[model samples]
Target: MPIYVQMARCCWIICFLVFSSLFRAYEASPGDSDQLYRACLSQCQKTSCVGARCFSCCNSASDGSPLDASWYNIKHLYFWWNHWDCQSNCRYHCMLYRENERAELGLEPVKYHGKWLSRRQYGFQEPISVAISALNLVMHFHGWRSFSNLIYYSLPLKPDKTPFYDYAGLFNIYGLLAMNAWFWSAAFHFREMDLTEKLEFSSFVALLGYSIILAIIRSFSLRTDAARVMVAAPIVAFATTHILFLCNYKMDYEWNTKVCIGMGIAQVASWSIWCGATEHPCRWKLRMVVVGGIFGVVVKMLDFPPYQGLVNSEVVLNASNIPLTYMWWNFIKDDAEFRTVNLLKKVR
Candidate 1:
């Protein structure tokens, strides 16, 4: 076999190992299993009690009847969902506590929207996830400003002189796509609506695939308009096709996961190898970025079943990933500026 083929095979093996190790370590530690229940009970003790139990305020049956008898009556009564902004999570947990107590007395577990309340988040809405998404959107918008300034003022005005200028449009598009993706991410986590979920997933996949294309184009120094378009067109088509397949036809979780993982590996690997091979000043920074990116992926994958705490998966993963990418982007831009300056000096 050719050495290049062997090297390519080795890179794939390493990526597979990285993902497998992350998958294996994706267990959430439910430390002190009764801590949340105790906390809920403590809060309940502070409120005015109807008999021995706290008043049904946030997520309980309104008829003041026993859950065992009126299970159907309040099964769908999610006060937290109705008044998400106003309802406290304490009240939600209190409702869960009540359900647990009732179940011990032979009452069946209650279902809301065809899902058992146990699987539902502590509250009807995921405030943490929403907040993280908002923060990520803000970061992306701020990066947009920085990126705009870098592209417009930092790059040479004469496109005939440098290859980096041809990429301005692609970078700008990437920023817009990132912001759009985060917007839908926040919306989906806020409401978990079907449409929002599809939008978020599609937008993010588009951003990921586009990032890979951008990395390849810039890394190889493909500055000509024709070369840039040739490389980007196929990637854009694939991303758009995948999004349409997901949103219009079937939202296949398994396929989505596979494609996303592939793109993520390609993205990190491309940049890492390019930075290593190039004479860029911030080459070493890419090493840190790739490591952080992998850890971020692990953090994202750890989000799983039994999401029953103040900490949310969406929040954690976004917080972990966004800053790393943000810094990585700045490093990339700096490297481009470095190259652009040298190119201008040579022309002068």
Candidate 2:
């Protein structure tokens, strides 16, 4: 044989040996034992093996018993379509069933056997699992669809006014609301209903409420230019951060954080620029930027336990300790978008 062929054969043998060793190790591992138990439980439930004992069969088999009740129960339940009550059986019966099934069939039962059998046997289960799956899929699709529509409609092709702007404005408003919904959901999930947590959560709700009121006022004030500018700032900032992350560019923490800080600076600068160009341009915008910068610096400086930096990096902060940071990002992005849209209208 050629030297290259000989080397290839050796490599193949080495790969096979490595895989075999790994498989053996996995089978011996404590974690794998827990996984096996979960797998067995899931399979038994799916097969509709009612009142079947599980633990006795596993233990008996481990002790080298001749009877394989677990295997029999699994096979029987797998073949027969039955009720959910099968899942609540005594551990001993299920174990015996498992042992019997294993002795007869020489293999463990499959997961989700009930659903698969139902589809094959009775055409489908009531409240068809497929329908539920489809509903979930459509919900995800709609979320992306809404995002795409917002992007397409919000940006002006030319500098002049057109119907596209109005459609885009509507889409953007809806998109912001949807984003708020996502944040609120996250807040609610984290809330423990404790007095302190409840108070913090309520503050988030208030912020969202105030944002909605501001949006409504802007819509009615005929200040679309200012609103466009405000809204655009956050959207652009966020989009920029997203693009960077997608392109694998390293930014400080996640894209959302960069966007939050960016939007805050941009909004203040836009206001300052506007003021400077107009009569009596005060230093309020500059002051706001300085204050925000100082606050960020202070946050970085004061690193308490659990509120300290993230484990992965020096600068990156732990998410659990920085609820306020997330709030800041959302608020900045929202305020910036609203202001940007309105500003654009002024220029137009």
Per-residue lDDT of candidate 2, residues 223-283 (tens digit) = 4567556544644453444544433532222222223333334333333333333332233
**Residue 10 CA displacement from its true place in model 2, Å:** 66
Model 1 CA deviation exceeding 4 Å by range:
1-124, 154-156, 159-166, 301-307, 310-314
Q: Highest lDDT, which number? A: 1
Q: What is the lDDT of residue 18 in candidate 1?
A: 44
Candidate 1 lDDT by residue in tens digits, 33-84: 2454446656554553423454444334466433344543566565435433
lDDT for every model?
0.64, 0.36
Assess candidate 2 and give its lDDT: 0.36
The positional error of residue 232 in candidate 2, measured at the CA in angstroms, is 5.5
